[model samples]
Target: MNPILQARNDMLGQMEQMRELSAAPIRPAAQIDGAVAEAGVGNAFEDALRAVDAQQHQASAAMAAVDSGQSDDLAGAMIESQKASVSFSALLQVRNKLSSAFDEIMSMPL
Candidate 1:
């Protein structure tokens, strides 16, 4: 196969791994489980938002590093940044669709 395509595939694989790592369910760490009975919606939403923000920040930083000649692997950085962009865009779409569904639901007759 072509080198660029192979590289892209590798980058995609890495992104998948990172996503899995990030989204792994909280295994109820012993102490926290004992302390809190239920995880609140606000906290979970906040955490998810924070994770996406962090990914965006990291992607930006990586791109900057590549631009400034501070990094060696241009392909890797570009791939990561692209992955971040795709992930954020997907998230935005999902949010929009959810909002639309919610609005539709609210408009339904009782």
Candidate 2:
């Protein structure tokens, strides 16, 4: 089997796992206490940042593995690399928007 196809299959397997995770029912925000809910929202952003960092590491490792002949899944490596790039770009955009919003709020007349 082609390594590219195998890498695609691996990615599909991961997607299925993600789908399974998404299948879990989400708890409504109203169900939680106000302070706890707010804290969770803050932690969620931190968690997302950590997740992006972890994915970036994984992508880097994948590329290294391919380069070193430790892995033959070039397509998988490239896909992971792109995922990391996209995630970083998204995070950057979010940061930019947040900064703009903060600046706008600060400049408002009392």
The global C-alpha lDDT for each of the candidates, from Candidate 1 onward, is: 0.78, 0.86
lDDT of 2 at 64: 100
Task: Give lDDT: candidate 1, residue 34.
Answer: 69
Error of 1 at 16 (Å): 12
- State model 2's lDDT: 0.86
Off by over 4 Å in 1: 1-43
Local accuracy of candidate 2 as per-residue lDDT tens digits, 1-110: 77567777888999999999699887666654444455554587688899999999999999999999999888889888999999999988887887898899999999
For model 1, what is the alpha-carbon lDDT of residue 110?
100
Error of 1 at 19 (Å): 15
In candidate 2, which residue ranges exceed 4 Å CA deviation? 1-26, 29-41
Q: Which ten residues in a row have the lowest lDDT in candidate 2?
A: 32-41
